[model samples]
Every structure is written in C-alpha cells, then in structure tokens.
Target: MTRVRGTPSPSAPARDDVTSLLRHASLTRFLIARVGSITAQQMLMLAISWHMYDLTSSAWDLGLVGLFQFIPGLATTLLAGHCADRMHRGRMVAICLAAQAVTAALLVVSTATHSVTREVLLGLSLVLGAIRPFQMAGQQALLPMLVPPSLLARSMALSTVVQQISVIAGPALGGVLFAISVVTVYLTSAALFCMSAVMYAFVRYDYIPSPREPVTAESILAGLRFIWRNPLLLGGISLDLFAVLFGGATALLPVYAKEILHVGPQGLGLLRSAPAAGALCVGLILSRRAIGSGVGKKLLIAVAVYGISIAGFGLSRWFPASLLLLAISGGADTISVIVRQTLVQLETPDRMRGRVAAVNTLFIGASNQLGEFESGVTASALGVVGSVVLGGCATILVSLMWSRLFKPLATRDALR
Candidate 1:
C-alpha cells in the first residue's frame, strides 16, 4: 500500500488541547462508578443521621454513632493500606461495594421490621468504617495509574465535582424517600451500591502489586512514617485534620434543622446539601482553571475563609442566611481539599501511594468522625449555638497556628 504523507492532522492536537478531564476511557468509567457509589453513600449518611436522632434525641447518642464509625478505621488503617498495595484494587473495591450493599439491605429490612435501633445503626456504621479505609486507599492509589500525569490535577478536581454533585442531590433524594418511607431510602441506597459495583467492573486498569514483604509492626507503620518524614505532606494533612476537627459545624445541622431553623426533613435535606452545592460550583471552576503559584498560601487562605464561614453559619438564624454561609464554607473547603489531595498524590511514589493514601484517609476519617463526636458533646454541654461558634473560632486558630508551625506548607509555590 502506497500512502502520501502530508502535514499531521491538527484535529489530534486540538482534541488533546481540549481540557475535559473525562476524555480518558478508564478515568471516565471510574468516575461513573464513583458518582453512583458516592451518591448512595451520601444518601445513606443522611438517612442514618436522621434515623438515629428520631430514635433518641440525645446528642451523646449521635456522637456515639460517629465514635463507632471511627474505631474501625483507626484500628485497621495499616492492614487496609497493605492490602491496597498488594491486592487487586478493582476487585477489592467491588467486594467492598458488595458488602456495603448487603449492609444497606439489612438496614432496609430492619427499618421495615421496626427493629432498627440506635445500636443496630451504630453496628452498621462500624462495618462501613471497617470497609471504607481499604476501599478508599485502593481507589486513591489506582487514580494515578489511570490518568496521564499532566491531567492528574484536573482529574482530581473533576472527581471532587462529581462528589459534590452527589452530596447535593443525594440528601435531597434521601429526604424525599425518607418522607415517603425511611425504608425506601435504604432500599434506593442499596440499589445504587449494586449498580456502582457493576460500573466498577467495567473499569480497565493494571495493578502492579508491591514487592512481597513480611507483615511486621514496622511494615504496618510505613504510611505513618512517610507522612511524618515529609513536612509538606505532614502540614497539609494535619492542617485539614485540625481545621475540620474544630470547625465542623455541619454535624450540628440536624439539631439546627429541628430546633433552631424550624425546618422539616425536607428542609433538613436542603441544609445538608447547601455546602456541597457551593463545593460543586467551586470544583467545576477549578476543573478548568489550573492552580497557579503560591498553592500553599491559597490553601491557608481557603481554610481561614472556611472557618469564618462556619462561624457565620453558627450565628445565622434565618434559613437562607445559614445556607449561604454553609455554601461559602463549602467553597473554601473545596480549595483546601484540591490542594491537599494534589500535593499528596504528586509527592508520593507509586510504591508508597497506597500507604500514604491510607494515612490521609485515616486523618480525614478521624477528623470527620471525631469532629462529629466533638460537636455532639459540645452541643450537649455548651448549647448548640455556643458549641458551633466556639468550634469555628478554634478552626480559625488552627489555621493560623499551622501556617506558622509548618512554614514549608505556606511557602509551597507549585503543584509539582
């Protein structure tokens, strides 16, 4: 065959220049699966929180739910990271999804049978907590393998956008379902998880398992060691840990929805969705615009803004005002999340990605759960308004302290 070769096609380069993050087949498939799974998870979370409060109006009981969820992640962090490094990540994620589907189904049954108690809910949270670390570690580690290095930041931003979309929609859906019947919410969540598992099955990727090593105490501690040794990573992770631990005002929304805001379950859903609504908008913007220089300073500024917004949320009595405040907080948080995740992913080697990701998961899980627990405890003692205000102030202080303490984090200029 004789072919005349001329100038190369401009279409190829033009297509490459287009900035859509979902261009890659593997990334697109993974994101679709993630959207389904995240939507289900968010719906389930709202259902569980509302159901727990309906059973017992006590704040401490709500806190215990978070505590139970945190314990499993704390206990099995190392083992989960190790598994992500050595196991088939896709298969592991599918298995985790299967387990979660079963759990959701059980909740449906329990709700229908009128046997769903706070204790039962707590138990299920423990099961989920155990499954989450492994699932998250595997997914985080697998992302770099799926996308070109240059597209990683955009991919992360796009992922956040999907998650934020789910966060906004899921709670609204859950509230509608819960209004019809609590059982319906659980059933829908179960169906979504099963669907997510099927979508995950379609993702094509290869896992290069880490070299085999004897499971030892030191081996298990590798993730923690890596974070500790790297100041930038340490600062980024710890900044998030402390900020969320102190500034988490969202945990008290259920209380505000009922007691302060005078809103019904539907209204509660709106409140739950507000922050994510803001986050979704911000993530969409970030997906297209690259993070420029002074990445560290931007992160710090974002966290401080988050704290300010949280405080504003705590003081607002009007529903619209509160929602706006929460949305601003979410927007600020989105920036911090993007910077922190990108930093962690770009800095770590592939061999250590799983372990480092596990450590990051632990910090995030702990901050969320423990923050919920703290909010609940403080609400019980200090009153909801006081607790939220105090926590928000603490978050602001944390941001300042971290900026001074970890100069490297504040001085960071670029993603690479």
Candidate 2:
C-alpha cells in the first residue's frame, strides 16, 4: 500500500511521540475537506428543520422528516459502499455535494415560490438521506489514505471539532436567518452547500477509489463479514448504536423551547447548539493531547458521563442547569465519538471502507432518527421529562450491557 509522505508508516515506531504525529501535510488537507462538508451538512440540516417546522407546526412532521432521511440509508448503504470502493473517492464526494447543492436549490425555489409542502420537504429529505451514506462512507474511507494509520485518531478528532463548530454555528446562524425570512435561510444554506462543493473541488488528492474484484454476492458480503468479524468495530459501532438510539436528546429541544423550558426561539437555537459546543471543547483538547494508552476505557467512561449528564439535563427545570447539563453531555458524547471514529478509520482497509463506513452511517443515521422517533413517541406517551430521563437511563444501561457482552472493545490492543 502506498503511504502519504511525511507520515509515520504503520511499520514506524508507535505514534505516541508527538513530533512524529505532527509531520503530515495531508492531514491538514484532509481536515479541510471534512470541515467543509460538515459545515455544509450542519447548515443544511439547521435550515431545513427550521423551515419545515415553520411551515408545518407539527412535532410529528419533524419526526417524520428524521424518518424519511434514515429509511433510505437502510436501502442504499451497501450499494453506495460498493460504488465507493469501485469509483474515485474525491469525485464521489464531489458528486454528493453537487447533489446536495441541487437539493438546496430546489428547497430555495420551492420556498421562494411558496410552493413548499411537508410532503415535498419530506421527499427531498429522503433523497438527500439516500445519498448521504455514500458521501459519508466515501469521506471516512478517504481519510486513512490522506494520513498515516497512526494519526487516524487525531485526524478524526480534528474533524469532530470542525463538525462541532458547524453544529454550533449552523443552527444559530440558521435561526437568525430564519427570523429574518425563511427564504433567506434556504438561500444561505444553498450558498453554503455551493461553498462546500467549491472547497471539495480544490482538494488535490489522488483519490481514485480502490478497485475490488468483480461483483458477486460474496464480494458484497465481504465488507459485512469484515465488520462482523472485527470485535472492536462491531462492539464500538453497536455500543454507540444502542447508546445514542436511546440517549439522544435532540427531539425534545423543540419541545423544551416551546413548552417545558419556555426559552423560546433563541433558547431553542442555543439548546440545539449546546452539545456541539461541549463537543467542540473536547475536540480542541484531544487535538493537542494524546488520547492516552487506555482510549477504550476512556470511550466507555466518556459515554457513561454522557448518560449522567443527559439524565441530569432531563431532570433540570432551571434553564441554566439544563443548558449546562446538555453541554456536559455533549462533551462526554464527543469523547466516545472520537474514539469510535479513530478505531474505525484505523482498522478498516481502504477497499472496504465504503461498505464499512456505510454500515457505520447506517447505525449512526438510525440512532439519530430512531432516537428522535423514540423520543417523539415516548414524549407523546410519557411527557418530555419522563421520556428524556428514561432515554438517558436506557443509554447507561445499554453501555453496561455492551461492556459485558463486548468487553474486548474496551482494550487498546483491540484497535491495534
């Protein structure tokens, strides 16, 4: 396998040494690419949700939007994964961004014409979601190629930070724009998507996707087999899958803004961004410091912290307490994400990265939307506080169960 220059090859001394880890130039370029994409994604999501709710005034509509996006991921993931492996990664990303741009344009046009409907928005969301797995899988697959195996963790950490920034800024910006005019928000999102497309166009990597052997059932199954066989990948992904599926608190933010918390639109925006702010802080810290020898243990512990923080947030009636708890939860969740992303990038091969990453996207997308669904349904049944608190508790319980069932993921050697 060809390695990027100025990087410590896997054969080199362990990357515990800081000097060796900081030498790669491609890492910078790779991070730039990820940041660009993440910023666009965050902005788009923020704008879309804001517009959707403004038009529909229904929590069920929001839940349905989440569902629309996630359902397509279930269908296109393997096929997208296969394409990622067979095609050029950079071009594939470019194509995805272009598609996003088109979607954004359509949204703008629809909104401008006052022709936007919940059904149209939901249909567009599903299409975007279908293409999302491929984009995400392609990017994850391409990262390892840009940097050395040893720095994969750090690279993912940096990307996480950038994403957090996007998360923080996007909604706040979207909210401001939405207050000005819904059409303005849509236009801004479209512009951001175009900016991302342009940034991706400038990435000068030789990213021809790896060519796998001829297509067959066995070839398609190869990626799944690899993920299934790898204890670390399976355990980490699964742990997050169940953990986030129950613990995710996003769906309730709208409710908090509208009813329980009584903070209003600004509060809603802040609530949306609270987790990302915490994650951004954690990301900055991780970028400078090594994750240490016990990254596995740290990941588990961080998630536990996430659960505790979320539970605390759920129980809080005070706005400040709620915000602080949510921020803390976000920080803890960031740690788990960095660890998981690092392990996946390091362990998966370039050829199968798309498939594995698509699978990863599937889990993530499912957890995100399903979490929303679970929250929505449970909230409808149990009240907001009860639902959120229960979800947080379920996350902790799931973590404990996963630790017992897949204890090997908690060791550093599993990653190696």
Candidate 3:
C-alpha cells in the first residue's frame, strides 16, 4: 500500500477508474441507490411545493416550507452526527429512506382522497428536515468505508456526477409526471424511495468500531473541536462556507433573467441550470483525474475562479454571456466542493468522520441559506447587478484571506 501520502491510490488506466469503481459491489450499489433516492427527493420536493401552492395559493407558505426544513435541519446537526458515528451507517440511511417512502405514500393517498392539507404538508416538511441531517451524516460517512482512501476522491467525483444528473433529471421527470397526475408523481417517487432503501440495506462495508462514546454535550461537540484542532480541515470547511456564502448568486438569477437579460421564464430555466451543467462537466473530468498535488492552492484558486465568474455573471447583460459565466462558476465550485469534501473525509479519523461531516454539512447548509438572504438584501440595496458584483468580490476576498490565514491548508501538497 505504499503510495503518495496524501494522494489517491495509484492511477488506474484512465478508462478503468470508473470501471474499477463500479466493480466494487458496495460502492456500485450505493451509487445506484443514490440515484434513485436523490432523484426521488427532487421529485418529492417539487410535488410537495407545487401541491402546497395549489392548496393555499400563498407565496408565504411556499417560503415557510423552506424555512421549516432549514431550521430543523440546522437544529439537529450535532445529534445527527453522533448517531452516524454510533450507528450502522448504511442501515441508518436505509431507515431514513424508508421513512421518506412512507411519507411519499401518505402523500399519494392524501392527494388521491383529497385529504391533503397545508398543515399536513408543513408537518411532513418538518419530518423531512429532521431526517435529512441523519441521512446526510450516514451517507457521507459511509462512503469512505466502501472505498479505500486512495479512491475516495474519484468516488466522490463520480458521486457528484450522479447527484448533478439526478438533480437535473428529477424535477423534469416529476414535472412531466405531475402534468399527467400529481398522484402519479408521488407514487413514482415513493417507489424510487423504497428501491433505494432496499438497495442501501444490501450495500456492505467493513467497519471499525468507534468507541461507544456516551451521548454527552461534550461528545456532540467533539467533531467541532476535532475540526478546529486540524488546520487543513478548518480551512477547507470554512473556505467553502465563506466563499459560497458570498459567491452564490442563485437567488438573483431570476432578477437577471427577467429584468436584466429580458429572457423570460424559458430563459430563466437555462440560467438556473447553467451551474449544474458546468459542475457536471467538471465532475466527469475529476472522476478520471483527481487533484493529486498542490491541493490547497488549487482549492483556493477554484474559489477565486468561482468568484470571478460570479462577478462576470453579475456584470453580463447578454443572456448567452450570463450562461457562460454561470457555467464557469459552476465548474469552479465543483472543484472547491470536491477538494473540501476530500480534505474533510481523508483528514479525519473513521471514528470521528461522522461528527466532522455533520459539522461540514452545517457549514454548507448555512452558507446556502444565508447566501440567498444576503443576495436578496444586497440586491435590494445595491441594485441586483451591484449586489451580485459585490458579493463576488467578497468571495474573492475570502479566498485570498483564507489562503493567508490557513497556510497549512494553502501549502498542503496532497489530498490523501
């Protein structure tokens, strides 16, 4: 097993990495199950949101749907991480998925019987919010178990590809099905959830037992301390938090597409999709060739590139230019995300990965929600373009500041 200390295992034939990855039955099954579950999640989200609107016709309720999910997801982060560390990770994911499946089935029955109501939807949303952190904790912690350290990054890239594709396809599929029948979408999504849960139950991995740490305030907080004590982990995670917090302009896409670019709803869809398209391309490239050296520097550069692209997107008046800028931003973000995740997974010990991952997820979740709020407030004050441009600049500044503040992270030579 002699190899680069912090690099992925020796490179397989470029063509074979993916095949090699697939040949690992556990990883393969998990990936397949992910496609089903994530796609179903997207479909379920769309159906629920649309149904809520149909029932209440209130935009405030639509916003409440997200708020409910976010707050609970945020509130349960530490406990969820503890569970991931203590539990059978894959089975934990299976249970979560199974719960979701039941929820979807209930939705189907309710919709069919005209028994669905806004309150039911909100309550379910609360349940979903609580479930997500547990699922995420288990799923992310489980990946390293299914693959060796060397293959972790490549596997993550491939996983990203699966996610991007699922995110893209799910809504469209759900939309088409919804147009046919709302009940149809729910039933289909429920089936997918059940399939993913069953597949997850069968995906096996070797396990090393972490001490059955007493569930204490200190134990729940251990992951946070572990990350803080490790500079690379802290830098990588915080960099993602701040960079995305400032650079993400997703909330402003509608403003640009509608008023600035004059592109209308059809164009807005394309704008919304530009980043995913870009991320998909980069994820594919990384699946074959991961960042091997100069890991820290590359991560910073990627964040900087993301910032520049966001700034460019903010300034662009042409529809095509906006798309290109957003795509570039997406590609850069994919690199940042992969690098950050790799760092977090590889640097942390197995027993502690769950807690560390939980903390990581919290940073990310906060960034996404706060980023949108920041964008809206700034757009209101600075004008949409000014707000976006300033946010991008702030992102770039964060990258530069982080590079200096976390030199160990910035000068790190490898990801292993």
Candidate 4:
C-alpha cells in the first residue's frame, strides 16, 4: 500500500511528518467518525435530561439517569475492551454505532408518538451505556492504526476538541429544539448517529491486531495483569481518574443555571459548553506544539490549574466570569487528560490495547457519570457551591499525592 504524503504507517513514529498527519484525509474521516458519534450521544443526553425534567420536574430523576448510564459502563467496560482486542476493531465499532443508532431511532419514535415512558427511557439509557464503553474503547484502539505514534498525541488532542465541539453545540441546540419539540431533538440526534455509522462505514482502514496464539481466558487475563503491574500506566490512568472523580462539576450545571446563576435552560447550555470551549482552544495549541519530557509534572500542574479554575467558577456569580473561569478550568483539565490518554496509548502493547483501553474507559466513565452522582449527592447534602469548592480542593490534593506515589511513571519519557 502507498503511504500518504503525511501519514506514516503504524510502525513509524509520527514526529517525522506531523503536519501531514494532521491534514490527512484518512485522519479527517476518523475525526468525523469520532465527532459524529460523540455529538449524537451528547445531544441525546440533552434531550433526555430536558424531556425528563419537563415531565417530572425533579432533580432526583436527572440523577437517576446518571446512575443508569454509569452502571452499564462499569459492568461492561472490561468485556467490551476485551472484544475490541479479539475482534475486528472497526467492525466492533460499527456494531456499536449501529446499536446506538437504533437506540436513537427508538428514542425519536417514542417521543414522536407520545409514548415516551420512564421505563422506556431507562431501558434505552441502559442499552446505550452498555454499548458506549465498547465504542470508546474500540475507537481509541483503532487510532494508532489511523496515524503514526508521533502524531497520536496530536490526533487524540484533535479528537478531544472535535468531540467537545459537538458537545458545545449539541446541548445548546437540543435545548432550543426541545422547546419546539422533543421529537425534533430526538430525530436530529438519530440523524447524527446515522451519519456517524455511515462515516465509520467509509473509514476503509484495516487495523492489524497483534498476532497471538489461540484466544483463551488466560490471554485476556494477561492484558489485565500488564496494566496492574505497570506503574506509569496505572498512575496515568489513576491520576486522571481520581482528579475527575472529585472535580467533575458538569453534574452541577443545572443547579447553577437555575438557583445560583439565574440563567435558566439556555444558560445551562452555555454553562455546559464553557469547559469544552476552553479545551477546544487548548487542543489547537497542543496540535502545533510538541509534548516534552517530564510531561508528568506538566500533567500535575495542569490538574492543579483545573482545580483552581473549578473553585473560581464555584464562587462566580457573573455569567461571563463563570464562563471564563470554566473555560480556564476546561483548558487545564484538557491538558491533563490529553497527556494521560497519550501515555496510555503509547505505553500499551498492541495485543493489550483493547483491555487497557477498556480499563481506561471504565475509570473515565466512572469519573464522568459516577462523579456526577457524587456531585449531585454532595450538592444535595451540601449546597452546590460547597460541593464544587470542596471537590476542586480534593482534586488538587489528590493529584499531588498521586504524583508522588507514581513517581516512576511520571519521571519516564515517552516509549517512542
């Protein structure tokens, strides 16, 4: 096969032609596949939240949605990751996309028919959550196949920004569309999922998984043991996990919009977007700049920045101030996340990528959805502001402690 002008094969490090890798068509298609799926997912979330709240007018219902979403992620992540390694990764991704698209269509039809019941919503949410971990794991594993290692960092960063773009737009659009008709929101979200499935269909690249002997239970266990023993990989994944577990404030946006900031639903959209907006800007910067040695230290500092920004946002009353603070928080948090993801991708062997990526997904999924549950519970117990402030402080302290504990992992340079 002829290599593109910019993209190197997986065997080559991407540092040689970073510019071309970023601009390559195949990479762009991969990005589209990523962005479309993520955007549709977030849109469905916005729709679900808005629709549920509109029906019940209860915060507890919103929290329950988070619970349902997180449970499947925790339960299925390892299995999903294992499958990614053993199966055709692209096809695995396609299967997940198809499942999600079906869920989206179901959501739309239910809404349009006015048959949207709580039971139906909860069931679909569970199915979506179950499949999402695999989609996430598969995509991450498939990435090294799309670009060279040197460019993996940039590609991952770019992928993050692109997903954020959808998130930034999805909720705001969902909010507006929901006011007009929940059916409209669901239909639009379903359309995006279909687009994503179509994009994945066209990706056309085959990822060659590591050739190992016959698949057995021991082989899967070996992947788990690898992550268990690798201090750097363990530390990198844990660092981000613990940090976000405490500091994730996305769950509190609705409360802030209503009680504290007085922005209402539209304001909620903007508030939800603040962090992504900041992360998007930072992603662009990292795409141009190369990561250096001692990225561990950088990761720690960035998380601290993230903690401080979350704290500042917690205290903020002005909309613009809150937005700016969240943006700063987003930027700092993004750097830490990107570094962690890059390290995970670089450190793992090809044979173990699915398992390791699945573990990564489990931690991150916990940080995101379970963290939301924690935040909501804490905010309900304490005030929203109190929860945000305390969570931010905990995040900073945890990152510092983890940095010390994982000193060996932090100090090492990239594998390439």
Best by TM-score: 1
After superposing candidate 3, which stretches have Cα over 4 Å from the reference?
1-16, 46-65, 105-124, 181-187, 208-211, 251-272, 315-319, 376-387
Model 1, 103-222: lDDT tens per residue? 999999999999999889999999999988888898887777776566677778888998999899899998888778989999999999999988777666655555789888787789
Instruction: Itemize residue pairs with steric clashes in candidate 1.
Output: none
What residue runs in model 1 are displaced by over 4 Å at the alpha carbon? 1-20
Q: Rank the candidates by lDDT, best first.
A: 1, 3, 4, 2
In order, candidate lDDTs are 0.85, 0.77, 0.81, 0.79
What is the lDDT, from 0 to 100, of the residue 161 in candidate 2?
Answer: 83
lDDT, residue 122, candidate 3: 83
Tell me the tens digit of each residue's lDDT in model 3 across 1-416. 22322223445433346887777788888999999998899788767766775687544465556556667878898898999998888899999999999999999998899989999898888888778888888998888887666678899999988887776667667767865788998999999999999999988875545676788999999999999899988988899889888887765655565578986544655676677778889999999986789988999999999999999998998888888998899889889888889878878888888899899888876676456656767766677789889989999999999989999999998877
Using lDDT as the yardstick, the better of models 2 and 3 is 3
Between prediction 2 and prediction 3, the one with superior TM-score is 2
Give the worst 10-residue stretch by lDDT in candidate 4. 1-10
User: Which of the two, 3 or 4, has more lDDT?
Assistant: 3
State, as a TM-score between 0 and 1, how close model 1 is to the true structure. Answer: 0.95
Cα lDDT, model 3, residue 369: 49
